[model samples]
Target: MKVDFRYLGRSEVREIAGGQALSFAPNLARSKVFFDAEIVHPLRFREAICALHDVVVGDLKFKKKDKGAYEAWKRDQAQKQEQVRQTLLDQARMRELAAVVKEPLPKNLKGDFQRMHRLYWDARNKWALELSRNDPELFRHLVPCDPVVTVAPDMVFFECFAKDESSYGFLGVDRGAFRTEAGAGLGTTNVDYSLALYEHFQTLRSYRPTRLLVDPSGFEVNIQGRTDYREEKIDLPASWLRGFGQLQAAMGLPSRRFELSVDVVYSILAFLKRHREKAGPRSLRFQLQPGKPPTVVLEPWGIPIVSHGRAYEGEKAEEIKVWGRRRLAPLARILPLAERFEVMLFGSGLPSVWTARMGEMRMVLALSGWTANDWTRGSNLDQFFADLQADPAAVDKLAGHLEQVRMARLTTLAEQTNVPRSVLMGSLHELARRGQLVYDFSVDAVRWRSILPVALSESMLGPEPAELVAGRRLAADPSTTVEREVMMARGARLVVANVGQSACEAVIDPDGSLTRAKCGCSFFYKNKLRAGPCRHLIALRSVARRSVVATTDRSDLTVHLMSGTYAELRAEADKRTVATGYVIEHAWRLAREAIQRTASLADPTQAAGVYRTPAKIPQSLSLPRALVEEIQREAARLDVSVSVVVEAAWSVAADQIRKSSSLLN
Candidate 1:
């Protein structure tokens, strides 16, 4: 039957196991096994507890003593119960349970409740299988076994039968036991415990545990919005959890992989073998002997000894903290989604013991955690390089984000590729000049703000047009439009002679050198290359058309030079050159001369002083009142400033009259 799986926390486990005082059922009987129409993993906890009860299990009883202590405990328990009741009452007041109980599990289905205990183990085993089979780079030596036993938050045991497989069949007297005619190899450490457990099961005639999965589905699960229940909440072995976290963190790098080739597996095994040699008893480091088979022997390091002194035939093995189990568990939930990958094995930060399976091959791998975050966080040089080569769009997006996040400087894009940062910087400069990408020193990388070419969003798709980018929109009376003004003020500046709204002229400073030049065009911005003027130019052309239509034609506005007028025009040209920093080039001078011959009159002085001035007469103030009155009366006769009246009224009046004549006349 299909049932949504969930992990059962300690509370639910305790409740179903019979709240502290409940005793195991008496006279428990063992039942014969039979294959069902549908075969599924049975809840092992119930079977184990029932088995213990059936065996008369040494009559389990509470060991806690001290009457006063018990009394205090009872009082605390009562207070806790009251608190729980109050909490439930509060929740009820909130009226949120209507949604919860609306589609609740069937009542009195205790078997379903018992199923939750299996979820944690199931997830772990399933995850292991997935990695072993799919992730050749991550789990090269992981092997599928006949029986997998799981005890939540602590142990997971997998067994493979040797010698006699029939004795280890699901049923009969030998039930689930491998009858090895030869004793288990001496010096085998944890393998002995597994073997012993297997042998004990045979004595009890119990069925083989094909795979022990702590199914969490049978629990009273209240978790909402969780599609993948195992990752939502899981209780895994502490060491395994740590390994999972490291794996997750490491797998984020898309380049990381557990190489599956036979040669790679053998090399990994060789690495592990060398590491195990010089490692002290229960210590985690090994020394590497150079020049011979690339030997790796352990040296004294920070590796810890977790479980020790339990080995078969006087051989001892310590439970090495392979990976940071605590840190890795959470990461395992997300590692598969990472963009890159790097394979690591036998490192100081890695798990002490790990078996990877690559197809038919199985071996151990080794690594040093000295430079681990690179492999773990998707910043691995190899991964970055590969991404740079294969998928530029994704790389650009990632780079842009990293730059935005201010990690671009820290990003070793150059190291990933042979390309130099100088070359990249030049390209970036060109792009920035073209207004394709903007660089902020406060930021780490160039930010991609889609300017110039309008982004086609859903809203834009439906709408006529939008003023989203930085530019001026031309009005119906285009003569008054400020497109040219806006471009001059906001766009990248061009060093040119005779720069005007129409027919702007400029020469490239370094001939044929396109590096520094930029065009304010949609194509230039979008493509990040210096191309000819695009849509912006077309738009400007439209604006120019309107200006031409609204303004007076300049065809007859010039004056031809004749004899004495030539000397005056020469003087005027000299003065214009000094004022504007631009001497007329040969062609421009010839064109100007031609235009002057065609024009009958010179261009007016652009309506001098268009700005309005104050109409009232001005007066200068003095500390003395008598001096101020004299100055005011003097200003009244000329209707001018006191300073103007005192300094030189005639000259000031002549200048004012010339300005007015220049303006209105």
Candidate 2:
């Protein structure tokens, strides 16, 4: 599959030597990196990329923009807390120290109580010490710094590199037309010589970019422009496809999604920049009071930064915790240029997504709970599997709709197809992961992009971890059973899956992070849940989650999962208890209901097929009157539509004749 980028620039220019900066595949570690992003203005995007690069090198030094406000807020709260502490001491003295006149209160009591108030302020002060002061002379690794870049319907990936802890740089681009000259299912070559031709277009003084163009050919990549044209093969890694699918799985996971206006986003960014270093709180806490705009509480210091833009209209009162808050600094470059911003928090220390909406473009930053949960280390292997397989029927329907509209928002496509937003989102995500769907950030809709070869394996996303192999082996042993037990005593459903000789209990606190996690494994004992989950815990997480694979194209087929688990909305991780009778009864009832529902929607005019639905439409065949009358009689005898009666008779007769012919052969 060859794809090309055509330059819309107006000026004519002479060719020059290309720089070595843009060898995307060469610069990036293929095994470790794969993401997708779109840029509207190359220069502006270049600026943002440079800023992010500087941040990783620690060269873009920034003092907390809200330092003054933070300090004042800290002082004010401390004074108030001190007064409260004084009153509390007086009360203690009256209650216990009343008989002892010399000692008004316990000597340790005052000091301990005072320390409680300083928890907020002291943490704020420590933010500076916690900041990464190490300066890398060379960019070593782009672990937390990599951003996926795409040119809309076309493709362009820039992989930032680092030589040392401080040194890194790697990225590539198509310096021609965004349209493709080659067809899908072809090969692309990565030749560094394309740079010289790219320089040829850069010299075009009259060249003015009309808009970003992307002509995608599933196979090869061609760089076409007004003055220059080049062709080089591009390789689409399986993991790249899996990266999107895994992301969709996370998006479908249950989480707290909220909107933050540009101003509000800026305030939070500024707050973190100023106080995150000495900020008292390690976590960015969101106080979401029903009907009121969310109040962002700075860590440790307890300094409350209210939203200056939009209000929190959600009636549900929720408190959200976000870790790795400082990782969001890269967004500062684009947030100022964005029209809107939305944040999706998936429990504390889980993956949090920050989406900045530009008019026709979007910038998304998916940060793990910590910098260590890397894209390559595979902390989210479960998500990749869960999102890998999608409903083929939903995919077929979405493809048809996307073909007609070209691009549309999730809601629009969902409405057009009469499919639920959540259900369609699952299929779309799977399609996108399979490289069949191209996400258009400008329209905020997923576009129809076909597989170049028309067939690809799901395993391209890569292999499962060795830990899973061990866990699965233990789970399937005859002597052991990976039984899943659920309890809701603590308001959070607890899942326990036995592995080998020991078992692990895990509870995903709705607030984020495993609030109640205990495993007999030494990993858990040493880490105490801080270093991330053990392999055993990961296996049990799978058991706790249910799976559904659609078997047919019909709107509703006999959908039954193992153990007849209860499913969550857009979530797959919940499985309630199951009983034999309940399972049997529910299965029969749903099948019968689907049949009745299908019957009503079925059309009488459809051609003979296994299952095709359309409304009744009379047609003139101009057949013999005798045949027509006979057909009516047969239809009456069979008690079915005339079309069905005739079609069935013809089908049986044709089958008998074919069988007879086969005997002759």
Candidate 3:
């Protein structure tokens, strides 16, 4: 089969890297070549294959910059919460608080309730004290310091380090136990089922034995001929490790109990009964009206409700009590104020149960949505497995249009193409990473096909013409023209300081114009500007270039973090202007300059044989005054050239200090 290649624009080209480019290139021996004067075209089949390769390679293209930013944000949020904690500590009457109440009451509570506002704030913080204060969403649940713990199936525990008794540290577990079994195939168990019940005495001394959630279907207790034991036990899956730990942590506290009204409690039981009789998994979404003439609406996530009124109160109350006692006993102490709660059960699989604690009441939630395979229509092949499925031809055409408009999304393409949804999705993803196709989120399926750039079938059947190849090669070389030169200047600087092997240096003239540049990484030189530069280029340019600049004695060069234990320095850096290795080097150089001034004054020969007179080291540390004044006139310039004046003054002052001190001595 013959394969052709399509050229991408600057923005579209940037998404892919070198590996994808090579993958998209034709295998001249077996495949036929294709060429176009302005734009090259290849067969859709080969394009699809090349696109797939591109997608795979691109997926691995980790964006370190984005990752670093996300980590920094997490750190910043933690610090901000600490600040809030400190402010709260300054307030008096910190003790005897239940929960902090927020404004905009449940559209009901009367006048006297306003006094409890401060109490709400204290309770919210109390709940957060047990959990890590780093998470704000969880922290909100703490009313003034009252710990609000969320109990579920797979819970584990962690002890808090701080030990101030009144400081609101780890008190004790109130609800369920956290368990880990010792058997194979445990990893396949559902996350919620793996919870262990926590048994807390009035004291913190003795704990009880906990049972892990096991598959009811897998419960095989056969009678051996004689006195025989069971073969093996099962364990929880590795995937549930995090959920298990969190669930256990919730148990390490005194339980905050609430109750659902008798009517509301009865309604929950009726819904569960109907779901038990139903075929597949069933869900009920309900809204609770707290005050006068209380009413609850039982809404399902998908299936329509046949009857909304109360049922099973007289007839099924006993059965409900039995099941509720077995499953709801742990939560029995706190069921009175359950305003709006949801419960979900799986016929044969793992069941997840949860209750969200709002103010006095809690709303329980369950995972009710169907699995991916259930939604997939294998024969239809056109619609996607998401909430909405569209026509296949429409999806492919949409994919084609996204390619023309230079958007990226094979999943969306599959939805549009109506081809086997999975195949189109996989293929579209391939094209996007290879930088051959693009996508836009704005358009519908019909409009998507309209946007793609047109490629004729005939244009993709042969070798690329010599003229086009030569032009492309020329475009890659930045030294060829002013436009290319400017583009390389910007890209070179961007990659110079990245954590990569390639390093490029740009020379700025006195007028602040980029005069000349060179990059050893070879990316910019090779005429490619996609997927940023490799890590090697970043290291060479950033680490190596900064090293060179440090030696240059430039006044603007700052010291920064090169390498060290983060914990040892993180606290100090927060207080004293934290920066990278480059900034740290700059600070050191400044100090060294001060030392040099003292040294020169102490030397007889350097001091011109005069005891108090200081010799000068002439250095033009800043640009000329005219250049500075010119930049000052431009509002768009980020940096003004006034730095020269500051440098000159600092140099003169250093000499003056040396002379005065020498005279005094």
> Which ten-residue region of model 1 has the weakest summed lDDT?
164-173
Report each candidate's C-alpha RMSD, comma-separated, in the order given: 30.1, 22.1, 33.1
The superposed Cα distance between candidate 2 and the true structure at residue 607, in angstroms, equals 68
- Candidate with top lDDT is 2
Model 3: how far residue 427 lies from native, Å: 35
How high is each candidate's TM-score? 0.18, 0.47, 0.17
| Model 3: lDDT to the true structure | 0.26
**Per-residue lDDT over 148-195 for candidate 2, one digit per residue giving the tens place of the 0 to 100 score:** 333223434222211111111222233332222222211222222122
lDDT (0 to 1) per candidate: 0.27, 0.45, 0.26
The residue-level lDDT of candidate 1 at 249 comes to: 26
Candidate numbers sorted by TM-score from highest down: 2, 1, 3
RMSD of 3: 33.1
Candidate 1 residue 497 C-alpha distance from true site, Å: 38
lDDT of 3 by residue, 413-465 (tens): 44444566534434443232222232211111111211112231322222422
**Highest TM-score among the candidates is held by which one?**
2
Instruction: Estimate, for each residue in 388-466, the C-alpha lDDT of model 1 and write its tens digit.
Output: 1223343354445533442234256455434454344333333332223432221123333222222222232222112
Off by over 4 Å in 1: 1-665
